[model samples]
Target: MSTIVSARGLTKKYGDFTAVDGIDFEIQEGECFGFLGPNGAGKTTTVRMIHCVSPVTAGTLTVDGSAAGVDNRALKKKTGVIPQEITLDIDLTVYENLLVFARFFDIPKREAKARIAELLKFVELETRRDSKIDQLSTGMKRRLLVARALLNKPRIIIADEPTTGLDPQARHLIWQRLRQLKAQGVTLILTTQYMEEAQQLCDRLVVMHQGKILKAGDPRGLIESEIGKDVVEIRMPPDRDEELLARLGPLACGHERVGDTLYFYCRDGIGLWKALVDLDLPNTVHRPATLEDVFLKLTGRSLIE
Candidate 1:
């Protein structure tokens, strides 16, 4: 796959505070590339530059062979954005909301009508087409947002926290639609705080922190590299951590104590489990290491705010 978006030493600043600081990354065509981070971590800012709405403070940023800038109308024409916020007009029916958006792309009334019908069905909001935006459920509204983004038949789609307030069933439905679009060869750029969302949709991703890239790789690869195959949690008192580590630390690759739990990351979990059982420790859990483990390990377990 060819590079669809590339950034070298990219920087974004508002006044003296920098949001993105000299980060470099590349996005491949027809892949779901994700930007994962905590709140105010510049994931949104980086994608904003990619979509050409926010200007780069300094750096070489290019999308589809053209330099990215706020004035790049040609680039904007082929890019679709599913914003984090629900920006639909409450007074308009779902169909009218899409109609107004389609007009922005200069799509003719006849073509817009045809495209809107197709998109509504694709998002499973066909029955809600004439329903007012305010009358729809949160899931229905989010699905409508997905349809609105596709009006331009874009080559690239940016989804920023697309399933913020959605339930499991609703979120999965959106995921299916996104996967369908990607299978059709649309390049997907996603920014999200949900680790499951990233693992589900992204073929590859970059984890951002304080305007910098901490790690970049496929979800499973990152999990394996940063955290081993299994994790053991012993919810003993903090004072007993040293005693427990002394007994089981050699079997695990690494250990950390957070709150009342001592976490053991290991490739050889069987040995670790056996050791814990021999010790007859209570409140012990051995589980598979996941993307969330890698995320917290890199980003720190503390609240970002």
Candidate 2:
């Protein structure tokens, strides 16, 4: 449970533009730590620094007791990366792809062969070992990426939007594999925009916006603190806001109007739900407050662009 990654006033810049503003957070060993944000929110930038591919422009960044730097070979050797993009060699067979990657780590020929066999099976691609990367489906390619990352037997794994284009079953399979890795004590550093992914995998996460940390906590704790226990959504015209607020406002802890819907955040939404039902209001829904709710509330529900 010791700190595996730590950053203090961490910052990253590209010439005149700053991609990661001053931010600070710590990741514990053997836990899935997440960086959650929308496109261009610096989640990728922050994690790139952690994995030592991108240089830090300012402040301190450390991983496993060493300062993070572009030339930090020791850190790089023990770290595995599942990049967002599919970086496999399309012309090579599944087995060949892994074979080449193992060489990069200087894994011996005999040992590499043994590990490759185990990994192909681990990702459930044993039957497709001889098949070309181009012949595999998107999910299959993603699984191969997972296997490739593990070839070095890394202590830390950085998964940057690893399940980006996968279907539900494929995504779940990836999740299961990741959980299995975590159970084996691999420190997982994840950067994703998927709130559900963060909630499902992360023991804790930071919600970033405009290159800055807006909030950080365990998912459920953040949801409860920022959004209460339940959410009541009423898809009514905005003009009715005042009328409904007069009657339902006192029963709820907080309320907001976005588009045609009025949202009520309550510690217990049942009472407010009953009030709305008594009013015979149409298009009303009562649901649990989720990480998505906390995300939108803190980062703004509007599109980032």
Candidate 3:
């Protein structure tokens, strides 16, 4: 597959803080790629630069082989962006809002209407076409934003924290539409703090922290390779660190103590688990290493604020 988006030594600095520090990655055609990190981890900032809204302080960025700055207008026309916040014209009805986006791409009169109708159906908002944006539910507004983003039939779509404020049902609905877009061959680069969202929607991802790439690969591969196939958490009293480490040390492939939580990563956690049981550790739980496990293992922090 051809590379749709490419970044080399991409860097972004605000004052003394470096948001994206010389990171590089390629987003291939027809792939759902993600930037997974918590707040201030540079995911949003990187997305903005890729969307051509934020200029890179140094290094190179290219969309479809054109320099991000040299061909921004063309790049913007070829890409769709759903920002962290909804930017729709809430005063306009659903149909009108979509039509407006189509017009922005310079679609002709007859073409814009046809495309708008199609998008409404694609997002399952056809029944609410005539409703005002604010009159729609929060989920409806998010769906409309996605529908509007598809107005130009962009090759690449960038979403920044797309499901941040949505409920479970609404989030699932949006994920469904995103899968539809992927099936239609739209390359997606999404920045999300939600691990499940990333795991379910993104085929591959890069987990970033402190303006650097912490790890990048297939979601399951990252978990399997970085942490392991499974994890066993032993919540112990703060002062019991020495004893707990001594008991878990032999079985753990790698383990760390963070506050009251001890994270143990190993394949076949059964052996490690048995050791813990024999030692009679307090508040023990054993589970598979999810994307969440990899994130915390790499950063020693939670994804949510």
Candidate 4:
């Protein structure tokens, strides 16, 4: 796979505060990469630098082998961005919004018209192409944003918090479009707080904290390697956390205590369950491990927190 993006010692600082501490990574063509972290963990900062919308404070970066100092316009043309905030113009119709984006690429009028129609259909917004921006549903607006981004037919797409706030069905609709993009071999970089969104879409991911990477790999690989194969949660009194930790030795290969919850991680959750039952340890329930448990294990808290 060819490298589509690369960064070495990438840093961004403001006065005395550092937003992105020196970090380095590469993204290859035709893969969905993710930056997974809580708010203020510098995921957006990284995306801004990649999009060339924010200057790097230090270090070297390149897109498609184009140096940071060269061909930024050419680079931007191949990159499509969906910012954390909505940027649609309320007065423009759905089709018109995309036509404006195509014009920025200096696409010819006749070709731009064809492209806009195709993009609208790709995002499932074809039926509502004439709807005024304000009259469209939230999901429709998001679809339009996606259509606008693809107006130039970019090779790489950057989505920041794509499903931040929407009903479950709306979110799923957006997810569907993203999957379609991947199936067509478009390289994508997604930053999302929603664990399920990242898990379902990303081929590999980096979990960031305090402007640093805590772990990196495919979601399931990171979970199975950083953590173990299984996790068992036992709810107990907040003050009894320490006691639960001590008693977990008979049931867990490794354990962690966060507030009133005791987490047991091991290769076999059912074995731990049988031990807990044999020892009469007070466990509420035993279940399979998930990305949520992996996040809590590494961060010592919930993803939202």
Q: Native-vs-model 2 lDDT?
A: 0.94
All candidates: CA RMSD in angstroms? 0.8, 0.8, 2.0, 2.2
lDDT of each: 0.94, 0.94, 0.87, 0.82
Show the colliding residue pairs in model 2. Answer: none
- lDDT per residue for candidate 1 within 204-249, as digits (tens), equals 9999999999999999999989999999999888887778888999
Model 2 reaches what TM-score against the true structure?
0.99
lDDT, residue 245, candidate 1: 80
Provide the lDDT at 7 for model 2. Answer: 98
Cα displacement (Å) at residue 213, model 1: 0.2
How do the residues 1-305 of candidate 4 rate in per-residue lDDT, one tens digit apiece? Answer: 89998989988898899988988888989999999888888999988988888888898888888865434888889889877787898888887888888888989999999988788778787888888988887777777778888878889999998877778998898888888898899999999878899888999888887677788888888877766777777777667666656666666678776677777887778777776676675646776666766665665575553
Better of 2 and 3 by lDDT: 2
Please report, as a residue range, the 10-residue window in candidate 1 with the lowest summed lDDT: 236-245
Cα-based TM-score, every candidate: 0.98, 0.99, 0.93, 0.92
lDDT by residue (tens digit), candidate 3, 43-162: 999988887888889999988988887348989998898878988897788888887778889999899998888888887898998998778888888888898888888999998888
lDDT score, candidate 3 = 0.87
Candidate 2 RMSD to the correct structure: 0.8
lDDT of 1 at 50: 93
Query: Model 4: which ten-residue window has the lowest total lDDT?
Result: 296-305
